[model samples]
Target: MSDATSPVPAAAPVARKVTSIGLGLLAVGGALSAWAFFDEDLRTRFGFGYMVGFTFAWAIVLGSLFFVALQHATASVWSVVLRRVAEMLASPMLILAVLYIPLLLVALLHPDSTIFPWRNPTSEMAEHAVHVKGSYLNETGFLVRTALFFSIWIFFTWFFVRGSLNQDGGRRADITERLRKFSGPFIILFAFTATFASFDWLMSLEPNWFSTIYGVYVFGGITLSALAAITLALSALKRSGLIAPELIRKDHLYSLGGLLFAFTCFWGYIAFSQYMLIWYANMPEETIYYTKRLSNGWAGVTVALAFVRFVIPFLFLLSRQVKTDERKLGMISIFILFGQLFDLYWLVMPNSFGEAGPGFGIPELGPVLFFCGVLLVAYGRFVRRHPVVAMGDPHFEASRGFRLH
Candidate 1:
């Protein structure tokens, strides 16, 4: 469609430069990853580190996909201008699918890998607590579930993204009707897939410790972080003169900032709800999860998460001036993204590092850099070729002047 031959705005050359820089970073990250793969000592560390990086990127991708679907499902006119960027952000699903192969291979071949305790249960796992759960925690089940999860995610992501791109060229009003028709059903599917995927990829890390609300907790971080990513990207495009200020007005940015504030509150509520219920019940099964995190220097990371995820964004965005100011909002969005990385780190690292606490050495940095490259390259290449805004959308004109009442 338009992605192939559209005459992009003045941003093409800049997007090309970004692609080049991403390639360089990918090369560096790939080299370090190879070293870590071959080195026996760093192999397990590499696996865990890669999970951190993968989840961080995965949240953004899934979040973007959700945002685009939500707007279509709600027929939200105010967010129409922002939807294209969300689509671009979600474009890396296949890349993530490919990256997951190594982790899957480890589960299948290297059963002794420490990254997934379920794959190689210890003697302690013989206890009834962990043993009983072994029915769903088996190797074959994990592989089958992983395949199912990716299939659902890839199909839906491709459907929404491709439909949007086709609309940009075909200029068919019927396309919008078809997308809206499917949006509701897709969301229902999204909820189940996202929840079970979190359990499979992350919560199962400890095997014995679990939370009924863990999926909701992960969902909060995913949407909040993805919104922040979209805001920052749109801000960058505006600053570079690729998108005119009037097209994506200050009021529109304020609307985005408002959503950021709302989801921050949602995240705070879920984080508190999960922790409060577990603390109140004080069961050995549930308490074990928080106990490890609250001890051995992990407490500091938890505190930082509280501030970044909730308190800081909650207070700062309350100001009308701040919400509308590109510079101010951009800063908070950057912090939120870093907070998302730390949040995922908190979830994934404590399982491996344990009493030693969090580690941020080369093993960790390598994968972070690699995924960062993947995001930049994926975004830059897509925006360079495609129309940056959904100009053919029926509501394009209406969204240009949309404002919060």
Candidate 2:
């Protein structure tokens, strides 16, 4: 049981620091991203870069939402203390909904732009697979589907965050039961929405290339990246003395590390499975996706992604000592986040560059920094406004005693 009682401590001081940094990054990243759009000719290149930044950030946010849902559905006790942080991490889904508008405008206004070939299919593209997929890939369908995806996300986020907040500081535990009951259904909704969203946003980038498991592939990254992000946040709170050592124990930290290790493996497994299936089939349409990524300048990025995202973390996190050590685990969490960005960059950039190879510069950095700012500000604001721990949860006391056997 928890040694601490009743009213949970507030996180205002930490919130201020996080929000300040977030605002600064938001300004700079917003300015640079805006500058990239001025030159119409460069719009296609930078627009695609913007997609990379957006996806990199959104994956983490959406993944955090999944984490919250999973906790409630499984009634997991160990994560009760940490669930508030995950809830805060996920609160940014609304922000992403707004950020998505500009991209949608681009989709609506510049369909002919190289970013989406279906908008203005070329002579060769006209005869290819783009033709058959026209009904599903049209601009209107894209817009409607985007709306559906965001609606599902917003409703669930509100339900969980609001419900949890309402239950703060020894309130009725019935709300907990209510949340738990609905969590299973929320996850079912998450799977369908996340899968289709991946299909619409990322997979559609390469209309000709299709993967039945693409959504699963992105899900692996999303959950893995979300866990890494959560680990980083908890580590920061611990180091800053915002989260008392007693509230978040070494067992909790170890659990976080073990999750990171497991998901890294999961992501790697999905990645290899997708590639292996495609390779074995030797189908031109599917193979083209790997071909672009595997050859020339892009090849190095693929190799680097696998090593940094999987192999390095897999080996480093194996030791029990490393999982419990804040500094050591924090360092890898940072890298895992970077790997998530690089993985998205790898997925989105190659299509824009084609045989010219990978391109990275101001255009790429702008959107990334912009989304980073948005996330920081959102999370900070959430922490500032509410309790950092789920003190109202019936399971909160048991979570304090959570330990590995």
Candidate 3:
């Protein structure tokens, strides 16, 4: 995909440099984790916290692939440039697969894991719930479903991105058509796989407590947070001279801002629905999930999640000017990113301690930064190796010229 007049050509050397730095961070992070593993208390808590933070960052990239797929399936015109941003964000899935090894070891090979309460054969929590759920929640099933989720996700993302890149050279309309056709079924498969993965990886933490709509709740945050992160990345690129500064027109930003706004509300609706039903039914099993989050210092985190993740984003993005301004949008994006981290922490950490809250410190901080490094490097490397713009899409020129009325 090399040409003299290409607007965003590949930068393989830079991608290699970024990938190397990412590897270095993983080394340091792993060493620190290994050192902490010698202490039993630190091992369980640190491992669990790291998984929470790593999954938090990893979800955004996976969510970006969903955006890209939906755009293709819908034949969205204005997102042609923006779609590239989503594509690059998805590169971290490759690394995330590598990261899952330790989690697998913890979940399947180890004697017990604090992160996955159901994995321990001897814990009272496991004894109470695992028997009932054992058929579905077995380690083999967990690993299999995880492998399937990533398989479906990674294959579709790779195919979709590779097709888009090929279009950069061939400019074949049929290529776009084939992609659009494939994207329809691919998205349905993605939804199914994501839902089951959520059930296995997250909801299983509590084991006994369950929600029918939990996957949808996770999906809402995934889409919204992914959009927010994309907005921030796009703004950074505009500022750094990576692409034409004027290329990120108000229309593009507006589309992103609109998704962010819509999903913020959607998240609130889903969360409220889940909480409402659980509260109304007052069943012991269903109530435990919310009860854990609402007690023992976690209450503060729950209220903060409502405001920071939903309320604040809702209020700010309500204004058309804020949605249209790159700086303002970027700020909101950063806030939403932090909200996602806090939100995941709220979801995963409390379960590890069992009716108590773990204080946040180096044990939590180190692994999170390490995983974030993996995500950052993967994204930076991806963008460097591909054109910033989907130059061959038929909608490319129209997207460039698009304006908000």
Top model number, lDDT: 2
Clash count list over all predictions: 0, 0, 0
TM-score for candidate 3, please give it: 0.92
2 versus 3: better lDDT goes to: 2
For model 2, residues 270-320, the per-residue Cα lDDT tens digits are 999999999999999889998999886888999999998889989999999
Candidate 2, after superposition: displacement of residue 19 in Å? 1.3
Off by over 4 Å in 1: 1-6
**TM-score versus the correct structure, for each prediction:** 0.96, 0.95, 0.92
Candidate 1 C-alpha lDDT tens digits along 1-405: 333353765767768777888888888887787788788888888888888888988999989999999999999988888788899898888888898898776544585676667665565554565678888887888888878877888888899888888888766889888889999998898899889889989998888888889999999999998999999988887777767777888789888999999998999999999999999999998899899989999999899889977899899999989999999999999999988988888898897688998677877788888888888898888877876678778888899879777
lDDT of 3 at 108: 55
Instruction: Return the TM-score for candidate 1, rounded to 2 decimals.
Output: 0.96
